[model samples]
Target chain A: MSTPLLYALTGAVLWGIGLMGLIGLRHLLRKLLALNLIGSATFLILVGLAQHHNGPDPVPQALVLTGIVVSIAATALGVVLIRRYFHLTGRTELESEVPEAGRDEEGHSG
Target chain B: MSNWLMAGLLFTPLALATVSLLLGFRQGRALSWLGMLLQLLVSVGLWWLVRHEGGFYYTLAGWDAPLGIELRVDGLVVTFLLLTTLVASGCGIHAGFYLEPDRPWQRYFWPLYWFLWAGLNTVWMGGDLFNLYVGLELITLSAVGLVALGGQAEALRAALRYLLAALLGSLAYLLGVALVYGQFGTLSLADVAGQVRVSEHALLMRPALVLMLVGLALKTALFPLHGWLPPAHGIAKSPVSALLSALVVKASFYIAARVWLEAGVAVASQWMAQLLGVLGAVAIIWGSWLALCQPRLKQVVAYSSVAQIGYLFLLFPLTFGVEASVSLHAQQGITLQVISHALAKAAMFLAAGNLILAVGSNRVEALAGVSHFLPFSLFSFGLAGVSLMGLPPSGGFAAKWMLLQASMASGQWWWIMVLAGGGLLSAAYVFRIYKASFLERDEQDHFYHPDRRLEVAAMLLALASLGVGVSGSQVLSVMAMPFEEVQ
Candidate 1:
């Protein structure tokens, strides 16, 4: 396979793995890391595609640059939120969702 | 002149947000209010310009497409711009009173709120795919921050969940945009639409559309993927909840509609349309059922949003399933639904927030003495609830009327049943609130006297929701849909 094709495949695999981790992981920090992994996978695929042309595509480069910045901001904010969540309650996982049939099923008192 | 106004439509909020951030709350709140009022004027100016001179596309910084970004002003954009201006202004005014200006929170809230407004305007006006990704990020981040402003543990946890889920959605959307750009060699919506119409790179485009649509669905909180919505929208402060419910979700959904109707309509098939309708149907029934079960007032409204959003999905089927002539009607119907929902939902949240503030609790049972104490706000809530229930002389009723007509005309009788059932279910929850509020209490519970200005602001929005129904016919004419008009 060509270099771009291989990189694209690897990126796709990383995305799949990251998504699986995001869904499967119960730890808040792990979930945030999984989300970052997905972001990296997307950026990698974008960079790979940018090289598909004879020279690097400027548009995708600009997009990736901006994407990296946005992803950083999002990750930073997420970390702050998780830190506070941990500070408030020592747990990392979200309050385990009760079954749909559980008692809080009705209007809950705040 | 209009071009400059168009640019102002995009940048004024950005400038105001920066100014507010630096100036702090004392000066920031006044400037934010002025910025919103200015946006209202600019939005109307753009709407009039689009209506009179027809929609136009301008390249940012004099750069052409496939290179520089584009800002598009069209019927869809105009309609949404108007919604953003009106609902945002109302929410801002309510928030001004909702949070005491003296509190340090104002320093934080005003800046983020304006940033969110700026982001919403970008979503509506951005013609380039990358710009939209940026816009969605702005909305998501600002919205998550707003949800966590109260600093409670529950609020923080919910914000974290929302941040993760929303980021995942954005990444997925970005991946789709990347794939589309790689295949089509362009990122502008118009350019992409042209490419997709000729079925160029049909293979790549299909997956791209799937990724984008699925991501948007998650962000929009449709059906099963909506696990993050109730918590995020419920735990936030009242004005924050109102903004999130009223406008934040709609930004992503607007992009979805723009893609489906404008760019990828040809690639989208009958089954895909039907699939959206089915998911919507389930969201309606499931959301309403959950809303009925909610013990707190805010949760009921939040779940009701999930159900109300289902009504919007039905538009996908109604638009693409039928003939071209029939699709126009469906298009108008869905647009009406969007606007009316914004008005009614914003009004409901503001009023509910007012009631909750006065009663010092969100439990429905705690609202017994509220009607007696804050009758005006309660009256506002009732009017807003009337619209929510799709009762007569309200925006929600008008939207439902149009959707009903479109479904009938398109012969999609199944959706008709869903609409009817959803409305009745909405009535059940709305009525539940009404019933609780009307109950005669044994002991007199003291209610906090809400700010008079805040109550008036809430009343104004509720009345506007009712007024929109009276002028419902103008909706189709005002939107002036380019695609349907051409047909």
Candidate 2:
């Protein structure tokens, strides 16, 4: 198999593994990490895919560059929100909170 | 002048947002009204230009074709563009009262609100794939930030969940784009569609199409993947919820539909479209069931949003499966559904927000004595509910009628059952509010009156939905502009 195809497959596998972790891991931090892994995998695939179309394609390169920036911004937002969630509830996993109303103890503490 | 409208649509909000962020609260509040007014004019002008002058496409700088970015405006784009502008402007006005003009948080609110508007407009008018990815990120980030503005533990947690969902959705969408670029070697939708029209590249097409569709489905909050919507939309401050339910989610749906319509239709098989329709059917049933069970008023509205979105997905199969005229009617029906929902849902959220603030509780049971204080909000809520329930002389009914007719004409009676059942289910939830609002409670003694201006702001959108219901032919005509061109 070609190097580019191998790299592309690796990226896909990483995405699968990351998705499993995102779903199975209840910790908000771990979920965030899993999300970032998916990002890294997608980016790697973008780079690998750039190889398929004769020589270097600037479009996929440009796309990867933008994707990286977007991923970083999303990661930053996730971190900030995760920090707030931890500080408030003292827990990393999100409890569905469907019936958790009438309680603002954590909110008041902050 | 018309060309400038497109650029103005993009840059004006962005420029105002940046300036307001630097200037802080007082100046930002003062400038946001002007910013909204400017947006309204530009959006209306864009619709008119596309209506009379035909499609408008603007490329970045002088570079053309596969090399540079492009922004295209057509009737389809304009329909959503106008909806975004109107609801956004209305929400901006309401935010003034909701956040109070003098509060420090409103400072954070204005810039992010404008950024969200800019992001949505970019998505609506985006002609190319790469630009859309960037806009999706902008939208997800800004919207997540807005959700956290509530700052309570619940709101903050909801914001985190929202951030994760949107980020993952967009990244997955980007992966698809990478494959699509690798296949077509072009980023522009027009160019990609043109390539796919002649090239039977299912090897490249199927994976790219499924990846993109699933990604967008997650973002659009279609059922099964819609776990985060209720919390995110419910916990945010009213204006943010209004924006999220009314327009933000629609942005991703618009992209998915555009891709499915313009490019994916040729490549995607018949069953794929049918599967999407089935998903819509399930979302309708599932979402309505949950909405009926939710204790909180906003959560019901949010889940109802999920149900209403299900109706839009019905367009995919119905459009591709039937006679040309049937397809035309389905398109018009779905467009009407999209617009009316934007107006009605935003109005409902604004009114619900007022109700929640006045009562100091979001529970439906707490709506007792609500009508005594915010009569206009209560009245407006009913009017919006009329549209949501697809009742007579409302936009929802008009859309539903067309859909019903199309379904009958096409002989697809299964969707007709789904449509009628969804409407009945919607009525059940909407009536729950009315029933609770009319209840007499001693809490009426301490009720806080919602602002007169905010009441009027919410009322205006409800009234607009009613107006569209009666005079939908023009909207249909304008929507046809894009349809005819596509043909």
Candidate 3:
């Protein structure tokens, strides 16, 4: 197999692992890291597969660059919100993740 | 003139976003009025231009497709642009008075609101797959900002969940874009569609399409993937909730429908189409049932949104592998459903906000005797609910009528049951609200009164939802205009 194809396959494997981590992890910070991992895997598959077929295409490379900027912005926003949530509630996990906090489903902070 | 109109349409919200960020709430409110008026005029001009001149492609910075981004100024796209201007301006007007301008964070609302508007316009006009991804991200992040604006614990928690869900969806969609580019070596949706139309191994692209659809579905809050939507929608400030429910979710669904329509004939199987329809059917029944059970008023409305969104997915089954006329009918029905739902839901949320403001509580039981004190807002809520329940002389009814015809034409008798059952189930939930408000209670006499302007904003949207039923044919004609290429 070509080098690019091998990279794409590795990306596919990483994507599965990242998705599982995202779903399985309860901590918000760990979830954010898993999301970043998924974003990296997607960028890998994007550039790897495009260059594998077309012999070094710039379009997918450009797309990957834009994707990186967007994911960073998203991650930054997530961190800010998670930090604020932690400060206010003093909990590092989602309410749904805790069995005791399930009764507050309809509770509004206001 | 048309080029200038396009520039104004695209540039106004972005400029407003930047300018609003530097201004205080009062100054921002004054400036946004002018900006909204300019946007409204530009949207009308673009709609008129597209109707007379037909659709054309607007390349950004003189770069053609396959190398640079292109904006598709099509009939359907311009229609959505006008719809966005109307619904967004309505929400903005309500936000001006609804938000307490004295709060420090309230200043941030205008900037985020304008950014969300710009992002929505981008999604409607975006012709390139990667550009659409960026636009979707822009919308998602700004929407998260809006949801978390109050900085309350529940609001922050809801915002985090929404952000995480939206990010996962975006990554899935990006993966699909990567796969499609690898398969076809193009990022422009039009170019990809053209190639898929003639490609011998079109089935090879099915995986990419499925990934994109699934991602868009999650963002759109389709059933089974909708766990993150209610809290986010219910916990946000009223105007923010109106904007999120009215337009944000529809943005993702719009891209999915565009992608499916352009290439599903070549790559989709009958089994896949039927599977989507079945899921939609379940969403209608299950979502409505849940909506009926919710104790909070906004939760009920949010869950109803889930059910209403299900009606849009019938487009997949009705169009796929069907005749040309059947597909066209389904498309028109779905478009009408989208337009009407946006108007009605915005009106409902705004009116519900007024009711909550008056009663000083979010629970449905607190609405007892609300009709006595706040008859106008309550009336507006009921009027919007009329459209939601698909009653006569409403746009929702017109949309369902068209869908009924399409299902019959396509010989999909199974979907007929879903359409009828969903409508009745919606009526059950809507009336539950009506019933709660109508209960006469003498003990709850103390109530707060909202400004008259908030009621007017909501009433106008509710009227539009009702009036669109009569004008449905004209809107469909605009959507039917032929495309003309321009250099």
Candidate 4:
């Protein structure tokens, strides 16, 4: 198989595995990691495709570059939110127990 | 004049935001307000120009499409641009009173807010796929930074989760673009639209469409891919939450819609559109159910966003059936719905922020008798809810009306059921908050009187949501102008 086709197949497999991991994993952090793997797979596919005909397509490469930067920024923000949640409740999974309505035990009443 | 105004409108916020970063926390608040005021003035000026002179296109570095970036200001772009600037400015104004004056994070918020403004405008004006991707990155990065701006441990965690999802989404989009470029050798959306031939590479095209749609779905936080949204949106300070929900997610969806209409719809399978519509329907119901169950006020609003976004996705299946007037109506309805939702949701988040400030808590139950403490905020919340609930004399009502008509006309009454059911669910949750706010509590309320300026800003947004209903015809006319040929 040609390199682009090989890359596309690998990307498809990685995406499938990553999605499976996302579905199976309960921990938010783990799910995020799975997502990242899927993202990396996608980048590989894009870069491979852009290399078609022995010449790189600047357009797709440019887009991938932009996408990479965006992904990092979003990852930074997501980490911050995860940290906040962990501090507040001491767990990574979404809090199942809804806080009672009338209390400010969390000290965030304001 | 128009071209320069467009550039200024897009870049001035970034310039001001950058300057604020250098100034640090001491002068951040003042700088933020100044930046906001400048953005508002520029947006208004651009809106007027678009109104009077029709849309204008600006090619960066004097290079045209297929080579350099192109920013085209159409009715849709102008409307969204106006919305972003308005919401950002309002949030800026509101943040002044909402955030502690001495908070160290103020230094970061102002510059990021402006960067976000510049990104939003660029995304709105972007004429091609690559340009759109650039705008998307700018938006994603700035938004991620904003989420982490809170700097609390939980906030950091949530920001990380959001970051991963965004990255994955961007990657998927990039892959799709690469596939298209390999097949067609063009980056310009218009060029791709003209060049794409379905028969030559059906298999390749299908996967590309799937990748692009899935990526956008994740970014838009469509039902199953919505893991990052609730915590990220809910935990962020109210102003940031408003922008993230009201504008940022919509930017991705806007691009997806444009791409689908311009390229994918013509060459892709009808089943794909139907599949998207199905997902949207699922999201509407699932999101509403989840929102109804949330304990926190902000979480409730965040979940509602998932449901509302589903309605926007329904436009995909409805837009492709050229012979069907019902599909056309559905398209129009979805367009109107998008605008109305943006306005209403922004207002709702702002009002929720004010209530949280007043009650000194984010918990919904603790808001007993909050209406008495902050009557205006409550009033604004309720009014915005009117739109969310699709009640009469509200833009939400007009949007739903069109949607219902389209459903009936198209005989796609299953979607009608979803729309109606979603509305009921929305009403249920809204009323839950309304009931909680009005409960008679005898204790003296310890109100954290939010800055009057912020309250006014929130109310102004709420009023704007209501005003959309009055100006529905005008807005629809504008949305209708683009894709007239397609219709």
Instruction: Show model 3 residue runs off by greater than 4 Å.
Output: A97-110, B485-487
Instruction: Estimate TM-scores for all models.
Output: 0.95, 0.95, 0.97, 0.88
Residues B1-487, model 2: lDDT tens digits: 7658866888887898889888777678789888878888888887777767788677767577566778887787887887887899899889887786655666888889989999998998888887998998899899999999848788887887778778878878988987887677788888788898888644687789899999999999877788788888888889889999999988898889889878887878789888999999999988998899889899999999999999999888887756878888888898899999999999999999888888888899999977777888999899999998899899999999998998889888999899889999999999889999889987355887777888888999999999889999987777767423341
Model 4 lDDT per residue over B1-487, tens place: 7766765777677788778888766587777767667767777787777677676666787887667887677777777767777777777777766777576666788788888888888888888777787788788888888888856666665665577667668767867876776676667777777766444554566667788889889899987788788878888888889888888999899989888877887777778878888999999899888888888999999999989999999888777664567766776677778777877888889899989888888889989988877899888888889898898888899999998887666667788888889899999999999998888877847778877777788788888878888888987666444322220
User: Over the stretch B1-487, how does candidate 3's per-residue lDDT look in tens digits?
Assistant: 8678867877778889899999999999999999899988998888888778888988887888777778998889988988999999999999999999999999999899999999999999999999999999999999999999976888788888888888989889989998888888888888899899889885448999999989999899888788788888988999899999999999999999999999656788898888888888899999899889999999898889989999989989999988998899999999999999999999999999999999999999999989888899988898889898888789999999999999999999989999899999899998998899999888888999999999999999999999888799987887787788655
Q: lDDT tens digits, residues B1-487, model 1?
A: 7667966887788888887888767688788778888898898888777777788786778888767778887887888888888889999988887887776766888879988998998888898898999999999999999999856787786787788778888889989988888787888888789888886547788788889988998899988788888988888888888899989999999899888887767787788889998999999999999999998889999999999898889878988857887787887777878888888888889889988988888898988867778889888888888887788989888888888888888888888888889889998999889888888787857778989988887888889889889988776676774532220
What CAPRI grade goes to candidate 3? medium
Best by TM-score: 3
**Candidate 2, residues A51-98: lDDT per residue as tens digits?**
877776676776677778887788888888888778888887776555
Q: What pairs collide in candidate 1?
A: A106-B293, A106-B295, A107-B293, A107-B294, A107-B295, A107-B296, A108-B295
TM-score of chain A of each: 0.83, 0.82, 0.83, 0.80
TM-score, prediction 4: 0.88
Q: At residue B282, what lDDT does model 2 achieve?
A: 95
Whole-structure CA lDDT of model 2: 0.84
